[model samples]
Target chain A: MNIVKLGYKNIADRPLSTLLSLLLLTLGVGMIALLLQVNRHIQQQMENNIRGVDMVVGAKGSPLQLILSAVYHIDAPTGNISLHEAEQLRKNRLVAAGIPLSYGDSYKGYRIVGTDHQYPELYKAPVSNGRLWQEPFEVTIGATIAQNLGLQIGDTFMGTHGMGEGSEIHDEHPYQVVGILGYANAVIDQLILTATESVWEVHHHEEEKSENHPGEENHAHEEADEKHSETTAHDGTPGEEREITAMLIRFRSPMAMIQLPRMVNENTNMQAAVPAYEINRLFNLLGVGVDTLSTIALVIMAVSGLSVFISLYNALKDQQYEMALMRTYGATRWQLVWLVLQEGLLLAGLGFLLGILFSRVGLLLISGLMEARYHYSFSGGEIIREEWQLLVASLVIGLLASLLPAVRAFKINISKTLAYD
Target chain B: MLITRSLTFSYDHRATFQFPDISLEAGTDLLILGKSGIGKTTLLHLMAGLLSPGTGHVELMGTELQTLSPAKLDRFRGRHIGLVFQRPHFIRSLSLQENLALVQYLAGKRQDKARSQQVLESLDITHKRYDRPHLLSQGEQQRATIAMAVLNNPQLILADEPTSSLDDTNCLNVASLLKQQAATTGAQLVVITHDHRLKAHFQNSILL
Candidate 1:
C-alpha cells in the first residue's frame, strides 16, 4: 500500500541487476568518501604537527626539509648549525623561546632525538613515568617507542650508526631509558629524546677507536675527547658544545616571525623555515593527485546516474502493459511517474549510506598503518560535516537521473499498449 | 451514463472509422461486435479517456471528457472508469492486493480493504492475493486484474476483448462477474470484442 513498498518490490523483481547497480553506485560514492576523509586527515595532521612551532631555524638547506625535520620527525636535518650561532639568534629581543635539536642516531627504526631539556617543555610533552634524560648515556623513550619495544625506564639499548636497522652499532656507548613520554598525538610520541652530547659522543667514540687510521686517529680522537670532556666538565653538563640538528623558534609577535627568517639567513648560516608556508607548498604539490582522484570519482558517480536512467527506462519499456492496465483500473500517469521516481530516490539514499559506511571502515584500516609507519594520526571513527553534503548531492543526482524516464512513463500510449497486450 | 456524438478516429491518414451518436444509461450491458481492425478498441480507449477522438465529444457522468485537460482527464478516467483488456496486464512487481490498492489511491478513493477482499473472493482468487501477477496462473492473473478494475467502484466499465484468452467455462464466469460488478456499481458496461462467442451474454448489442 505504501509507495516505498512498491519501490522495494520493483527492485526485488530483478534482484541481480539491482544489486549490481547498487554496488556500482556504492563503490563510486565510497571512493569519493574515502578520498574526502583522507584529505581531511592529512590536513589535520599537518596542522597538528605545526601547532606550537612559530618558526624553524636550521643549517641552510631545503626549507621543506628544515620544517620536516624540526616540526615533524621525518626526513634528515638540512645540516647542523653551531651552538654559538644558535645562542646569538636566541639573544634577539623578539625571540621568546628556543629549543635545540641534535639528531644523528636511531634505536631500531625510531629516531633518537638528542636535544636539551627545553625540547620536551617547548612541545608541552610530559613524562608519563620515570624522569627526563639527565645523564649523557640516559634516554627518554616516546610513548609509542616504549609500547612497541617493550622497554621500561631502566632498560638499556644501543643506538645504530645510521637511521635504519642492521647498521653498525656504537657498542661502547649504549644508552639507558630513563623516561617515557605520554601520548601527545604528535611526532614527539614516536621518538627517543636524549641529551645533545650523547649522540655526538657515540659517533666521537667510534671515530677514536677506528683501526683504519692508527696515526692521526689517536691524536684527533684525543683532541676531540679532551675538548668534549672539557666542555662537558666546564659547563657541568654532559654535552653543551655539541652541534644540534635544528632549533624550534618561538617569537613574541607576528612581526618577529617575518623579521627573524631574513636575519637568520643573512646574519648566520642557519636557515629559517616557516612551517605554514612549507606545509602549504607540500599540500599544493599533493593537491593535483587528489583533484584527479576526485574527478575520477565524480565521473563514476555520473556514470552511475546514467545507469539509473537506463535501468528506469528499461523497466518502463518492460512494464508498458502493466502501466496501461493500471491506467484502465484508475491509476493515473502521475502515479506511475511517482513510482519510478521513488525507486531512483531510494537507490540514492541506500547508496549514500553504504558509501559512508565503507569510508569509515576503510579509514580505520588505513589509520593504524599510517600511524605506525609515518607517525601521523587520523581519527578514523569520526564522521565529518562534509559527508552529509556528499550524501545530499548524490541523492539529487539520482532524482535528476530518474526524471526523464518518469516523464516517459507519463507519456506512454495507454490505448496502444492495451491493444498490444 | 455514457454519451458520444459523431465519434471519428484514424490510425493513419489513409483510413478513418466513424461511429454514430450513441448513449447508454447506468446498469446497462452493451456488446460492441466488430471484425478485426474496426476501431472497437479505439472506441473503448476514447470512452476510457485514454485517447482523444479526432472529431467527437464523449460525455461521461455529465462531464465532457474530450474537453477536459490532460491532467483532469487522467483523474476523471481514474475515478469514473474501469477497463479490462483481453490479455491480463498487471504491474508484475506488485502483488495483487497492492495493484488493487494503487487503483484506489489513484482514484483518490477511501481505501476499501474489505471491498478489495470481496472482489478477490468473488473471482475465486483470494488465495492468490499476495502473489505477484507473474506468480499467479493465467486465469488467476486475469481475475486479479478484474478485481483491481472494480476496486474503485467506477461509474463506467470498459472491456476490450476480456474473454479472448478464456475457455468456455472461464469466459462465461468472467462475463457473469463483469455483469455482476457493473450491476452492483450501477455502472454502464461496454464490451468491445471480435469474439462472436460472447454475443449471447448481453441483451443490448451494437454491431459495427
Candidate 2:
C-alpha cells in the first residue's frame, strides 16, 4: 500500500524487462568483482612469499619463469646452477643469508624441495610436529602435503625422478617424513622440504647404480646423469660435486641490491633475478588482459544502467494514467517521483547482491582451478574497500538512470492525463 | 459543506471555461450534467483541487482550496474529497483490495483492512478483492472504484461521467450505489455526466 510496495509491485509485474536489467547488472558487477579479487589475491600472494628474499640466482632463462619457480614454486626451474658457484656468491660481504633450493623430484606431483632450515625460517613457518629434517633423505612436509597425502610423521615415500607425476621412482633413496609445518599460506605450504643432500642423493644413487649394473640404464637415464654432473662439476675437489636448482638471496643493505645482481649476471655463470622486479614485469605483462577485462566489465555496467533507464522510461509511459490516478487519489508530485526512484534503487540493490553472489561463485571456481594446479588458493572471505566504492557507483548509476523518469512522473499533468483517459 | 465561487480556467488560450458557481451542504447529493467538450471534467478537477482555477475559489469545510500550498492542498483533497472517474481507474499493479487500501494511506490515514473489506462488501465486490482491477468485469471495476472513492469517508464525493458508458440498468445501479455510499458516510455526492439515464437517480440535478 505504500509507495515502495507500489514501486516493487510495478517492477514485478514487468518480469522480462526487470530480468533483463538484473541480468546485465549481475554480469557487469560479477566480472568486475572477479577481476578485482583475482588481482588482489595474486598481488597479495606474490608479495607475501617474496617478503625476505631479495634476489633469485638460477640457470639463465626467462627471469619471470625463474622467479615463478624459485620464489613461488609454481613453475619448473630454468636449470640447475653449480652449488660451488652459488656458495661463492652467498659468502660475499654484501650478502646477509642465502637459502639454497634444489628441487627436481616430486612425490605424487607435489614438489619435494631440499633446502636448509633457513628456508622455513624465511617464511616464519613453525614445525607443528616432530622436527625439521636433519639427515639426508629425511623429509619435513608442508601442511597441504600432509593433509592431501594422508601422511603422518615417520611415514616414508619414494621421490619421483622428475617434477611431474609418472616419473621413474627412486626407491633406493626413499624419504622419511620427520616433521610437518603448519599452514603458512605461502609457497612452502605446497612443498616437501629436506636437507640439500636428499635431492643430490636421489640422482647420485642413479648414476652409481647404472655404472655398477651394466646395460640397465637407458639414454634418458644417461642424459639425466650427464646434465646432473655438468651443473655439479668439481672445483678440483674429487667425489663431491653438488648442484642446486636456485639460491634465494637476501642483501645486507640496499647498496647490495644495485651491485650484486649485475655482478652475478656478468661475472658468474648463474643468472640473478630480483623477485620484486621480475614480478612487476610479470604483472605489467598481465596488465593488458586485466585492463581489457575491467574495461569490458565497466561497459557492461554502463549497459546495465542503460537497460534500467529504458525499463523505467518505458514503464513510465504506460503508467501515466496510473500516476494521474494516484495523484487524484491524493499522492503528491514528490511521492510519484519517489515511487519511480524507489523502483530504481530496489533494482540496483538487488542487482548488487546477486552480482556479488555470482562473483563469489566465480571465485570459488577459479580458486579451485588455482589450488588444483598451483596449490595456492585465493581467500574471498573479506569484501575489499573498492567493492564498497563499487556499491556507491552502482547506486549512483541507478539514481542517474531513474532521474528523467522520476522527473516525468513528478511533472505529469494530472488533469490532462485523466481527462484524456 | 462544499462551495465553489465562479471558477474559471483556460488551457494556454486555446479554450476557456467559466464554470457555474456551486454551493452544497453536507450529506446532500447533486448531479452535474454536461456533454463532452463543455469543460465538465475541468470543473470537476477544479472542485477536487486537481487543477488551479483561473479565478475564484473552492472552499470545502471552511478551508479555501486555493489558499493551501500544493502539498497541503493534495493532503486536504485526499482527506476531504473522493473522486470517481469515467473509466474507473485504479493503480494497475495493485489488487482491488490494495487499491482501496492505498486510497486510505494517501489520505494520511492508516491502511484499515477491515474498513477496506467492509467497503468492498458494501459494494458487493468483496469476492473479487484479491483480483487486480483490470481482471475484474466492467461492472465489478466500477463497483471497486466506488468502494475506493468512499474508503476514507470523505466530506465530498465527485464523480466525472461515472455512468457514461453503462447500460440503462447498470447506470441507474451505479448512481444508486454512489448516492447510497455518500449517504452512509454523510458526504455530499456530485456525479457530472451526460448519460441522462442517471437523471432520475439523484434528488438534485443541474444540466449545462
Query: Which structure among the candidates has the greatest TM-score?
Result: 2
Assess every candidate by TM-score: 0.85, 0.97
Clashes of 1: 0
**Candidate 2 on A1-421: residue-level lDDT in tens?**
7998898999999999999999999999889888888889999999999999999999998888899988998787788888888999999999999999988678887888889999999989999989999999898999888898899998998987665565577888778999999988888988999888777667766767767786777743543423232123233563345788999999999999999999999999899999999999999999999999999999999999999999999999999999888887788999999999999988988888888889989999999898888788887547888888888888888899999999999999989999887
Model 1 Cα lDDT, one tens digit per residue, A334-356: 88888889889888888888888
Q: Can you tell me the DockQ of model 1?
A: 0.54
Candidate 2: tens digits of C-alpha lDDT, residues B1-208: 9999978999878777998888998989898888778988889999999999999999999999999998888888888899998898888888988888889888889989899888988999888988999888899989988888889989999999988889877888898899889989999998898887887777888887
TM-score of 2: 0.97
What candidate 2 gets wrong by more than 4 Å, as runs, is A212-240
Write down the C-alpha DockQ for each prediction. 0.54, 0.83
- TM-score (chain A only) for the predictions, listed in order: 0.88, 0.95
